[model samples]
Target chain A: MVDVPQLVEQARQGRPRAVARLISLVEGAAPELREVMATLAPLTGGAYVVGLTGSPGVGKSTTTSALVTAYRKVGKRVGVLAVDPSSPFSGGALLGDRVRMSEHASDPGVYIRSMATRGHLGGLAWAAPQAIRVLDAAGCDVILVETVGVGQSEVEIASQADTSVVLLAPGMGDGIQAAKAGILEIGDVYVVNKADRDGADATARELNHMLGLGESRAPGDWRPPIVKTVAARGEGIDEVVEALEKHRAWMEERGVLARRRLARAAREVETIAVTALRSRIGDLSGDRHLDALAERIVAGDTDPYRAADELVEGLTNGA
Target chain B: MVDVPQLVEQARQGRPRAVARLISLVEGAAPELREVMATLAPLTGGAYVVGLTGSPGVGKSTTTSALVTAYRKVGKRVGVLAVDPSSPFSGGALLGDRVRMSEHASDPGVYIRSMATRGHLGGLAWAAPQAIRVLDAAGCDVILVETVGVGQSEVEIASQADTSVVLLAPGMGDGIQAAKAGILEIGDVYVVNKADRDGADATARELNHMLGLGESRAPGDWRPPIVKTVAARGEGIDEVVEALEKHRAWMEERGVLARRRLARAAREVETIAVTALRSRIGDLSGDRHLDALAERIVAGDTDPYRAADELVEGLTNGA
Candidate 1:
């Protein structure tokens, strides 16, 4: 209603409000958002998209804040999407993070946005990537995506980010929880946040031991680095950023980044195609003939493939 | 490799081996399996399907076994599909349940099969429904689906079955885990399994209290009944079966079965359509032109939807 395409264009030219509005449109899964993305596509891929994920109470926000401050010190424009899927308990915590990052509010060089997952599974699948697009288009050199660390949603970060950083808290039961959950395979860098806490070293050691147990499927010589961070006190933030840059460089050198990007694009296209096909087939519901075919399929008088063939034939040949 | 149509035909005539083969083929998601199901679809709807699910360690297997035994007592043949998804630590726990149901192996009237969910999320998605179809075609009067107690997969059970029974183990925390997780909304029959345990009464009280909080969304006079059961001792099995029967009758009287079966048929057809689209898109990887489009999308020069449009155009009209 607010000239969404015009806002997307303005956002492409580096307007903050326009960027915010564009992100909201994408997050809402607006039908026309894809058209705008097509227009803005060439301006992306420059930003270093780093995803930070871990279980709740792992200090991801503090570590992210420290990283933002560190990146800013080096004269880099930074964008942060601190993703918290809305829970009453986490809502208050996210508000605290908003207040914590307000120091950068006056700084044009550092832009921080909090995106709530809003019950979207796999950490706001469409919104997370689109937010990166906005931040990248707005000329941010680095975009940090801090995702809420629910078990299943965490994996989506691996799909969406250029580099994924998995955080773990100290004395949070067995480090085995992190290792056995397929989280070990997803991280491009692992961070033991709250390193000042007791048993932090032990957790890091456990993670390293577990990481060594699995074979890497990633096409690179780069093994994910484990960085310890006491984010509240701004300790070890530089090292994490350094490790990320190193991984990015290594991936580029090995051509892994380009290959990964291609795979991601192919997957996205397939998702779109599938969505289209599903919708088209969903249209069959309104037709009585199609309904009879469905009943026949359900009744076992005909197989689904034959029914599908008939449906497609009807669509193609105007049956 | 088997003559699937002949097997399907034999399955319709109540041959156990034929039924087992047909179910395996369908569960395998093999292309040929669709023909078998299409042919057998008219033969379905004879069995009343029951789904049992809850949090892990809730004694679902024991409860399911008891239900099977009870159904068998009434001279009704029963089929069970005990689905266990593979976890990182184990290949699958399906074999364990199969061993548990081994006591019923000698009984020709009772057929039990255990399935691994493989990579499918929400355990009940593919294999569970296929098993139900095969059993239905095999002339089983009752089909029971047992799911490993992950909350997300349990939601699928409600829509998949004629009557859904959510089993809650007594003294497993506050019973809030199942309630807060939305498992309570899905069950048509709530069973306090392991009712001999301490806090059994409290668990029943909590379930009743939660049930009272919701105005029934289920049609007609069919409110889900809460039955207490010590499945290990076979206590309260009769009441559980009675509740299942009453719910089944309620479903039939209100034409809910036809509606549900209708919905399932539509969903199955849609899934096949989506799968076909996936294969079509996957096959397009032979061309490098699509590769260029992907880079633009990742680079932020293109949005996914328009890129998809481009794909369609490229495939259909010479672009």
Candidate 2:
């Protein structure tokens, strides 16, 4: 309804309200959000997208809040998309993360948005990335995307970001297994949050040991830096920020940035493709042809792949 | 390649080897697994599908192993599908779950197979239920679907099972958040897996308090029983088994089982529809027309929904 392009331009000029309005529009309104995103896509890739993810009570939000506040201290505008997983039935936060993070509400230099993983099968998918784009286009220097917790979805959040931080806590035994299952591969920097807690050192040592066992993909020996932080108290916050910068430098020095950029483009293309495919599929509603195929497949009359192939050929060949 | 129908008949006749082979075939060969499932669908609803999921290192495998051994002691032939998150690179277990579970390998009364979460985005999907079906058709009195550590993917496992048991450890801080995420709602039974730990009682109390906050969905005070167990030592194993049986009865008596069947059927149908649609779009893989539309959508000249409509209409009208 609003002059979105004009508002986008205003946001590009660093208007905080315009930025906030743009993010809200992009997140809550899907169709309109896509329209705004189309206008803003070219303006993206400017902000360094940093993803921070960990288990619940691992102080991810607290760490991210500290990071936002820290970046602001250095005169860098920051945008935080704190992804929250809500009770799907009740539509309420188990922990009101957004409300707890309301301390930054008055700081114009800092923009924080709490995103409830709405309607999507997983938290922080379509809407979350689009929201980041809005912030990125709005002239934010750093865009922090925080996930609800560590899991497969958390790894996804890492994939979308320019730099991925896997947060770990003390006392979770066999943390190595958690790391080995795709988490270790995704992290550019590992933060042992709540460092004041006992066993944090041991967790860090275990992570370093595990990191040693794995082969590094990046050239020039890019070991993911492990930083210790008590995010709630803002202790060791500067080191975490420095580690992020150092990781970026390492990537740049090794020419991994170019590779990362190419990967990002491919990912961007794939994300749009998958989204378009899903949306197109939704339009089929309940086609009798599809239902029959399902029955045949379920009845052992046909294989799923073969049935899939038939459906594809039939549709594509102008059935 | 073995005679699936014959094997199904043997499983129905309560042959454990035949049941084990049936599950193995499903696990190793998914395409053939579907063929086998189609043959076995009408034969389902015979075995109770029980899912065990929680955070890693919380003794889920041990608990499952104990449960399977207990059920066997009671003369019940049990089938165990331990779903391990397969390494995306190595295509093997991140942890040696199967090795830990290999105790039942030589036992005639038990069938234990570790399944890798192949190509599944998170915790477990399609494969979990498909494997369960093989066991059910093979006429196992109890089918235990064991999932590695809790996260978003873990939630999917709950929906797949008739009775879901959520395992929790004593030291995992803020156990309440796990409960608050509606895990409490899905769990038919709750197990404190490592009761020897210091905080086990606290975790149990937290679970009970969380459960108490939710309104009872079942009739006549059907509160999910919370059983404490040191699964490694097999302590409280009988209580866990009793809890599962009691929960299953509650489901049947309250007509929840029938409703669950309908829900699962609907879910399976939806999955088939989506997979079919994905394949159809996939067929247009090299076509310039779809790619051009994607570019337009990405360029903001067309909205995703309208693009979807165009795609559907194009397919229907022979573009």
C-alpha lDDT of residue B27 in model 2: 53
Per-residue alpha-carbon lDDT of model 1 for B128-192, expressed as tens digits? 66668789878899888776554344456544687888889888763676654456778888898
Docking class of 1: acceptable
Q: Taking the tens digit of each residue's C-alpha lDDT, what string does model 2 give over A207-251?
A: 888777355565567778889999878998899899999988887
Output the TM-score of candidate 1.
0.84
Among all candidates shown, the one with the greatest lDDT: 1
Alpha carbon lDDT at B27, candidate 1: 72
Q: Looking at the true structure's interface, with contacts defined as alpha carbon pairs within 8 Å between chains A and B, what fraction does model 2 recover?
A: 0.10
Docking quality class, candidate 2: incorrect
Worst 10 residues of 1 chain A by lDDT: A84-93
Models 1 onward score TM values of 0.84, 0.79
Q: Highest DockQ: which candidate?
A: 1
lDDT of 1 by residue, A123-173 (tens): 355456666777887789999888755434446655458888988989985
